[model samples]
Every structure is written in structure tokens, then in C-alpha cells.
Target: MKRDIFLSELEILKGIAETLNEGTELKAVLGECLRKLLQLTSLEAGWIFLINQEGEYELVAAESLPPALTNPKHQALTQGDCWCVSRFRNGTLTKASNIMECKRLENARLGNWGDTYGLVYHATVPLKAGEEQFGLLNVAVANKEKFEAHELSILESIAYQIGTALKRIHLTMKEQDIKIVEERNRLARDLHDSVNQLLYSINVTSSAGIRLAKEQPIKEIMADIQRMSQHAQAEMKGLIWQLRPAGLEEGLACSVKKYGEMLGLEVDLSVEGISRLTTLQEETLWRIAQEAFHNALKHSGEHKVSVVLDYKQNTVVMTISDDGVGFDYAEGTFLPSMGLKGMEERVKCMDGKIIMNSKLGEGTTLKVELPIQQRGKC
Candidate 1:
């Protein structure tokens, strides 16, 4: 019987681990987790309360509790009023019995109508990971019931499991956020270098041209205006490149090679058999190649670049490298002169790997590999 119970707990843990790792949002998963956790642990009512940015534990979800829980006045939850949540926020494990009497609830109104609720025992535990407390889990029941000592131990284990899992999810999200910021930064840089300067020059020259055009007597100055107009037209073409992805339908390799030729660089793009690839795989390859070409010309200032696409086992891979001065990528540093970080982020979103190999004067090579599972129509 003991072995059966242990196996059951393991199975529940497996289910929880799977659910948490499914890339589901933390709040949604935690709400669902509370229900499963309560059922698994044989608790009557369980709730997961998340601490807000202001450090208040607001009831996120409850499996069962006071019907009046819907009413704010009935819940004792207040700003900075939850001890378990606060503890978790600081990465501390805390457990308390008779949870209603906990410090946060002592001064709480708890709503006078829920007197029958007071007779039940409540336990509060911190849901902790790292040094941050994302929330608290509470188990409550009215009427006297004894909690087995082993049961409390198991609860502690569950809390630890929840904390570690939550930390992993948080880390993944943080990396994604950083990548998004990097992409935006790269786009801004592109505009500044390729579009902004040209437009600024055009504006200055156009103003001068208008002043000269006003003087019909100065035929020599008219030539200057005509020259400035040619520069403005060139700037407009650069803007068009910015407005549209130059090579998407033709494939990423095509885009990269086109971009290289446009920049007067010798670029060779290679593609192996991708007859079995879905559209998502092809698009991702295209984006990666596109970004790689942009990075080489605009950032590396390299005159030559190469892109290789291949399928190895279940992974689709794109490798782009250039013979330019390489910089340290391990520092997690984003140089304004380089858009490497932004390129890294886009690859990561596809559940891909971005490996940079470089040394000073040795040149830089970027390899992105992704496990392709079809997410769109073929």
C-alpha cells in the first residue's frame, strides 16, 4: 500500500512536470496546478496566490474556498499582507499551520459572514524559486482534521518542485525578452545607418536646392540641385529595402545572396535537400540567412560571406560566416556596431541554437540549428 501511494505521487509529479514544461503561461499553469496538486495531495481546498509587482498576494486561483471569495472583502488578501507569498518572493521556504491566524490575516477583516470558515485548519506555503517568490499556495479546510506528518513532508517536496520548475520557465522568458529588445535595437541601428543619414543629407541638400532653384540667374547652382536630387533618389531605394523583406518567397539563401550582391560582396549560398521541410522551416532558414547577410555587411563590414543550409537527422541548420575581425560573443555583450545579439534572439524563438565561433582577426561564423516540427501549411 505504501509503495502504491509513493507511485501515485510520482505519477502526479510527472504530470505536473510535463504541464509546467509545456510552455504554458505561469499563471494559467499554476491555476491548473493547484487543482491537480490538491487532488493529488488529498486536500479539500487549495489556492495559488501570486505576488504582484507591488508585493501583494492576490488570489490568482482557488480550487475551493469561501463562496464569498469572489467578493474582495471576504478575502483577507491585502497589499504586503501575505507572509507565505512574501517568503517565497525572497526565496525562502515557509510553512505555517492554522493559516488564518498568520500575521497577514490577523488584521484582515476576513469578512464576518465566513465564521464557519474559521473553525477549519489552513496551511500556507511559499512557492519559491531562486530569490524571488512568484506566489503562495494555501490549503484550507473547515472542521478539525489531523494532517499526517508524512503528508506535510510531501507538501514540502511539492513546493520545492514548483519553485524549481517556475524558475526554469522564468529564465526562458527572460532570455526571450532580451532577444526581442536586441532585435528592436538592431532595427533602430539599421535605420540610423542606412536610412536616417541619407534622409538627413537629402533634407539639407533639398533645402539648399530650393534656395538655388529660387535663383534662376544661377545656372551653375542648378547642377548642384540636380546632383542632390540623384542622391535623394538613391536614399529612397534604401528606404524601400527597409520597407520590404527583399528575399522571402525566393528562400532565405536567395535573399542573403541578393543582399550580398547588392552590397558588392561576393556571397555563395548553398542548400542541400530540403524536399521534406515544411514552410516554417523554410521561412526560418530565410530569416536567419537574411539577418546573417545584414549582420555581415552592416556590422562586420566584410566583403565576403557564405551561407550553408543542410538537414542533419531531425535538425535543419543554417551556417553563415565571414572573414572579418571577430569579437567576443561569450560576454553577452551587444555592440552598437554588431547585431549579433538580435540574430541570436530570432533563432532562439524557433527553439534553435546560435553558436558563434570567432577570434580577433580570425573572422566570425554563426551556426543556427533548429529541430523542425511542422507548425504551418506545407
Candidate 2:
């Protein structure tokens, strides 16, 4: 019987390994793995939370959640803090163990959300690859209060596998992002060397023709050509700017101010403390600033925007605000239509924090904080 149990455990591990190796899409992979785990363990339900460095948790994957948790689109799981997440954030949940009780579930019961399916307790496993902790893996059985020691051990192993998979996915994504940036730089260089030079040559030649022309009609034609060539040159430069920003060579502040000016906004830029940032950090900030500025240009009716860059003891903070007519904005929720999702993802990739505030009549504010020291994981 012991040997049989060992074989069954080994099979489960093999199945999970296959699932982890299947793909790089985080939510799909995690959801499939959770489903497989619950099936093999005879557990009623399971969910996964990916917690970032700033204590913000995302419900990345789940399987067979009860009505209480599912009603209103998993609001119960996404909105509030639970015991497992609090423990994970405080650095106490180092391994697999039975948590006291699921706070979210208790809230659902009290709020009369719906049935919880008797899922009041669960085993929480801290997912970690080596020294880096990713998040938590939780499994629950209806009316099952405590998990066996062997069960906890198995869960620990599974969580370790999931953690390793998470690391692999993250590294792959970073590599892809780096490659994309490099390609964009190469394309920008090519455009500047080829098309931009050609346009400049045309403009210069047209201007020389206008100066040398003996006939008035010829001079007028040359002037028209010159105007068209100059316009084309300006358009090409704007395209190259989109591909790769120009003024970043100077500094982030210079780049941001120039971009805002190009967008026809009065930029109030301020900087404090010595500037120290990695290349990746600078690029991330630049991209986020571009998005914010574009959003402000499209939505905010104000003509001026304020930008503040401050360096603290261990972090850098950037605040972009405009005093225009604003739209309703939630703190954690990002509106898909406004292109804030990309900004959020970029910040999260760098282990940073982003906070947004807006009201109907007041202006909008976007603040991002990034750690000074680089982490090996990111």
C-alpha cells in the first residue's frame, strides 16, 4: 500500500510537471495545473494568487470556486485581504500549512453572497523557486479542517514546481521584452540613416533649386517642393520618435519634457536628488510617461501638466498630474480603454508600484514608485 501511494504521488508530480512545461501563458498554465491538482488530490476547489513586491495580489488562476467567490466576477477574492495573503506579505508563510480560516470565505458568508460549499479552511503553500517567493497556492476540501502531513509535503513539492515554472515564464518574458526594445532601436537607427537622410537631401535640393531658378513659375514650383519635402521630413521624424525616443540620451526629465512639448502641452517638470537608473528602468519609465502623456492629451482638456521626479532613500517616485476635467478612476482597477494596463504591467515587471487618482471635475494624477536597487528576479 505504501509503494502504491508512492507511485500515485509520483504520477501526480509527473502530471504537474507536464502541465507546467506546456506553455508560457501564465493564467492558462496556472488554471490547468490547479484543475489537475484538485482532481488528483480529490480537493473540492483551488485558487492561485500572484503577489507582487508591493503587497498587491492578483487572482491569476482558479478552479471550481463556489458561488460566493464567483458571483459579481470574483469580487470576494480580488478585493479584500485574506489570512493567507497577509501571511505571505508579512513573510511568515514560508511553507505549506493549514491556515486558521479563509477570511474571504467568512466575509462571503456574513455578506450573504452565496453558498461557499463548506470551504472554510484550506492549506496554503508558499510558491518559491529558490530564495525568491512568487505567491501562494491554496487547496481546499469541503468541511475538511486540517490536512495530513503527507498532504502538506506533497503540496510543498507542487508549489516548488509552480514557483520554478513562474521563474521560467518571467525570465522568458523579460528576454522577449529586451529583444523587442533592441529591434525597435535598430529600426529607428535604420530609418534615421536612410529615409530621414533622403528627406533632408530632398529639402535641401528643393531650397537650392528655388534660389537658382531664373523663372518665377520655376521658383514657385521649387518652393512648393521644398514645403512638401520639409513636411514629409517632419512626419518621418515623428515616426522615428515613436519607434525610439530621441532625448532620452540627455536624461529622463529632458526626454519627458520634450515629449510633452511635442504633444503641445505646457510641461512643468521638476527633479530632485542625484539621478541613478538602469537602462531598463529608464526605458520603462519613458514608455509609461509616454502613455500617461498621450492619455492626458486625448482626455484632459487642460493645456498644462505637472511632472515631479523625486529620489528617496531606497526608491524613486514620479508624479504626473494635470488640472483638467477628469473621469472617474478607481485606485486598483485599470480602465482598458485608457491604455493603463500596459503601464501597470510595465511597473509590475520592474517590481514597482503605481497609484492613480481622478475625479469627474478634478484632474488626474498618476504616481509610480520604483525601487533603486535591482533585483535578480526581475
Candidate 3:
């Protein structure tokens, strides 16, 4: 029996390592870790506390926790220091063998709710990678009891793995932020050189027109204004095209397909008669498709989604459809929910139209039509 238990615990740890290696988002990874730990170990309830930038251990994930433990008094433990937490903070609680019953639970049991969860003894492991400690991992079962030596070791190992994954996640987020800021700065510089300069020229021309009202021809000033206005429009479109979308550079179809895969959905993509599309048109279509895909996954509860990107003369048509429980979209009643309003606003900005087709218990389809080439672009 002991051998079998050891093997099962090892397998659970392996599964958790694989999940972290996949570069899954941090929150999802932490929740999955807690769940796997609960399933494999004697612990019935578990939670993870992560130290935020403010250096306070916040409850980021929990499983099977009772209402009393989640109440305002217990939540204050996030920012407040307790014996177990302080031991970890002071570098005394380094290993899982340093087991102790939680004073917080003892205090809560004395409260009006009356030991709502029966939570007493808990194993507190520091989430440490190298010299850095991210936070603490707490796991407990009902009543006061000591944990086995092997169990403590397993819990400690899992905490170390979580710490390592947290480090990677932190670095990944930092890199992404730096990239976004750099891209925005570059776009700002481009706008200043192109559109900003042109607008300034228009301002100068108007001032000259006012000064030379009798000497200058009104038609010439009007012509200058028209020329500058057209150029400004084109420049603005170019800038908008450069706005960020995770997988846009690859292609709109590819980006949407990858997005669905990330959401654990199979997306069938069909593209026809398109060698390439103008950046502005591609971006607008991509944003609308992204919003539609998110809505389908969140509210639709569908396993599979279908996407089609078709290019026709002077027009690009994209459709996203899902087979899930649909709602009655009256445009007024359901506009705010399911994020349809935001999608509509995006389409309007692109000077395009979005058609919604759905019925309760049927499905949803978002059909978008955008001009392939806007003013001054072929």
C-alpha cells in the first residue's frame, strides 16, 4: 500500500510539472496544482498564497474551503502576519518537516461560526526557487494530526516546482510589457513624423490663407486642406494597423485558429481567394474575430468553433459561428452582456457592419464585412 501511494504521488507531481512546462497562464497553473495535490494526498482542502508587489501574502487560489475561512476576518490574514506565515517570512520554516497547527484556524474555531471547516493542522511550505521566495503553499485536512515524513517531502517538492514556474511566469510577463512599451514608443515617433507634421502644415496653410485673404485664391487654400485631410486619414489607418494582436503577423486566419486552440477548442478555418490583405483590413477583421471568439468560449459553452475568412473584390468577409446554448439577443436587452456592445463599437470604428444570428438554445454567428481597401490604399 505504501509503494502504491508513493507511485500515485509521483505521478501527480509529474502531471503538475508538465502543466507548468506548457507555459500555461499563472493563475490556471496554480489552481490546477492545488487540485492535483488534493487529489493525490491525504489533504482535503488546500490554498496557495502569493506575495504580491506589496509584500503581502494574498490568497490567490483555494479548493474546498469553507465560508468561515473565506470571510473578512480570515481574509485579513492575507495582509496580516500570523505564526505560521511569520515563521516562513523569517526563514525559520524552510522544510516541510517544520510542521505546525495553524493559530488562525484555532482562533476562527472560537468564533461564532464554530469551527466551520474543522481545519486544524496544516503544512506550510515556502515556494522558493534559488534564493528567491515567492510565497507559501498551505494544505490541510480535517482535525489536528501530524503529517507523515514522506508526505511532507512530497509537498515541499511540489512547492519548489511551483516557485520555479512562478519565476518563469514573472519573466515572461516582464518581457511582454517591455515589448509593448517599445512598440508603442516606435508608433508614437512615426505618428509625430507623418500625421503630426502634416496637420502642422495644414495649420500653417490656414494661417497664411487668413493673412493673404485678398491675395490668395480661396480654391487653392481649400485644395490644400483636402490634400492634407486625405493624407492624415491614410496615416491614421497605418498606425491603427500596427496595434497589437498576439498572433497577427502570421495572418488573421492563423491567429484566430491558434486562439481557439488556446481556449481548448477545435477551430475549423477556411480561407479562399486571398494572397494577401491590406494591414488595416486584416487588423480590423482580426479584432472583431478575436472578440467574437472570446464571447463564444466564455458565454456559449461550446466545444468547437468555426471560422471562415473570405476575400472578395473590394471587401473582406469573416464569420465566426459556434454551436452552443444561445441567448435572445434583442440588441437592447443583451447588448451589454456577452460583450456584443464592445464588438459592435469596434466594427463601427472600422466603418463596418456586424450581423448577429442566434436563437435561444440554438447557436450564435457573427458575420463581419469590412472594406478591403480604404481611402488612398489599393
Candidate 4:
């Protein structure tokens, strides 16, 4: 008889593990677990609760429960608390404990609202894993048989599995939150580099036009204003592209060309090899390219720019160059600006390198080299 009981308990534990692993949905997993518990222990009914963010217990799942126990007016599952739940809620009952008789059941029997069905005893187990407290698991039975130590141990093991599942779900939610924050930060950086700079340029151009109006030809001043207006339109389009993901879907090379065309610059793009990269790596390259292009447009005064993407067996290299006059790199006086620093930080975070080469009267070249297997490590 003892051997038969041990086999049954082992089978129940196997079923519980399978139930938790089979699904990622919390309520479905927990509901199935409660059902299996009732089958294994000969319990009449069972319920599981989850503590909300506000520290109140909420009914998450139940099985074979009586109507009186589930009624909203009675608030048996929602508001009212029995001795077992009260003890569990107050941190007094951290493990599976038997309640010889529940006040809730006794009160219902006395009031004659419904049949207690001989369910005078129940057990409560704190559903917890590590430091995470999910809520409580309750099971009731009609028989007067006292819960054995082994029975409580089985309950505790099942509760531990449930808690493990909940912990994974929690961590998954936190990861999603982190991704959202990262996206927001990317949008902020793009706006600052593109739209904000264009606005500043418009202000300076308008002021220059005011001064030139007194000395230069009206036709020339009008032409300058027209050019500035075109730049404004291009900036607006770039901002819209950043807001929407259409450019990203079209591929990085095509998107970069479109951005350059909008800005009225000649773009020469070259791809030497083909390879695959993670979405994050692709986005990083695209953003760094956009920043380099913006710098060329604003400072290089070059009519043409070149961008090259080279994919090798173990590494990918990017080169951005322009034909405009460049500054001297020998002067240690050229401190890194915010945009440059941001680019450098991004490259370093990915275990990459950024190299800049320039001399007076020569154009600047920016090179970025990144390992190909960075995503594989993740």
C-alpha cells in the first residue's frame, strides 16, 4: 500500500513539471496544476491566488469550487480570509500547513446557505521560490484523514515548480520593458542629431540672410532662402522616417541612399560581400552611418560622399569618406564632441573599433570594424 501511494505521488510530480513546462501562459499553467493536484490528493476543490502589485491577493485560478465559495457577495475568494489564508498572508505560515477546520466552511454549514459536503479540513501552501512570493495554493478534502508529512512535501514541491514558472514570466516582462526603454533612447538620439541640428542651421542661415540683404543681390538672398527651405523639408522627412520603420524594412543601404538624396548630396554606396547580422547590429551600423553623413553635410561642405560596407568571414568593416577639406588630426586639441563620443561608446560596447584619418586639405575617412560573431555569443 505504501509503495502504491509513493508511485502515485511520483506520477503527480511528473505531471506538474510537464504542465508548467508545456505553456508560458500563467493562468492556464496554474489551472492545470490545480486540477492535477486534486486528482492526486483526492481533494474536492482547489484554488490558486496571485498577489497583485498593490499587495492584495487576487483569484488567478480555481477548480471544482462550490458556488458559495466563489460568490462575489460572499467575497470568499476575493475579500474574506479564513484562518489558513490569514496565516499565510501574515508570513506566519511559510510552508504547507493543515487547517483542521475552516471558519468559512463552518459558517456556511451553520447558515444553511449550501452543503459543506463534509469539507471540514483543508491545507494551504505558500507559493514561493527563492525570494519571490507568488501567493497561496489551497486544497480541501471531505475525509477526516490527517495530512501526512509526505503529502505536505508533495504540495511544497509542486508549489515550488509553480513559483519557478512565475519567476520566468516576471523576468520575461522585465526584458520587454528594457527593450522599450532602449527604443526610446534610440529615437531621442536620432532627433537630437538630425532635426535639432537642422533647426539650428535654419536660425543661423536666416540671420546671415538678414545681413547679406544690405549688401548682396536680392536674387542671391532669395536663392539662399529657397535652399534653406529645401533643407528644412529634408530634415522633416528624415524625422518622419525615424518615427516610422519603413526605412528599416527597406534595408540599410537603400535607406542611407534615400536620406542622402533628400539632403541633395551625391551618395556613392558599395557593398563588397553579403552576410547576416542581428537586428541590433544592423541598426547600430545604420545609426552610425547616419551620424557620419550628417557631419559631412554640416561641416565637410562636400557635394559627394562615399559609404562602403565590407563583410568578411570573421569581421565586418564600414568606411565613410567625403571629398571636402578636412581638419588636421595631428592636433591633440580636437577633443571628442558628444556625437563622436556617443559613436565611440557604441562601438566599444560591441567590442568594436573606430578609426579616423584626416589631414589639412584632404578629406576625412571614418572606419568601423566589428566582429561578426557578436550575436552568436548572445
lDDT of each: 0.60, 0.86, 0.69, 0.72
lDDT of 3: 0.69
User: TM-scores of all models?
Assistant: 0.48, 0.87, 0.54, 0.50
Clashes per model (N, Cα, C within 3 A): 4, 0, 0, 0
Across residues 30-146, which tens digit of lDDT does each residue of candidate 1 receive?
777777776665466777775543343556667766544434654454444455665555655455333545544344334443434443456766666655455566776555344
**Better TM-score candidate (3, 4):** 3
Candidate 4's C-alpha runs over 4 A off are: 1-7, 39-41, 52-55, 115-117, 195-378
**Where is model 3 more than 4 Å wrong at Cα?**
1-7, 22-24, 52-55, 72-79, 215-378
Sorted by lDDT (best first), the order is 2, 4, 3, 1
Backbone clash pairs for candidate 3 read none
Residue range with the least summed lDDT across 10 consecutive positions in model 4: 1-10
lDDT by residue (1-378, candidate 2, tens digit) is 121122378888999999999999878889999998876767789999988887878888999999999989559988988888998999998989997678898888898899999988889999999988988998887887788788889889999999999899888877887788889889999999999999899999999999999999999999999999999988888888778889888998999999889988999999998788876778878887888888888889887999999988788899999998998877768653446777677677678978889999999998899898744233
Error of 3 at 220 (Å): 14
- For TM-score, candidate 1 versus 2, the one ahead is 2
Candidate 3 TM-score to native:
0.54
Error of 1 at 214 (Å): 5.5
Ranked candidates (TM-score, high to low): 2, 3, 4, 1
Query: Candidate 2 or 3, higher lDDT?
Result: 2
Name the best candidate (by lDDT).
2
Give a tens-digit lDDT track for model 4, residues 6-122: 347678888788878877666777888888777776667888877532244668889987766765566666766678666766778789988887777766666664655667777
Q: Please give the range of 10 consecutive residues that has the lowest summed lDDT in model 1.
A: 1-10
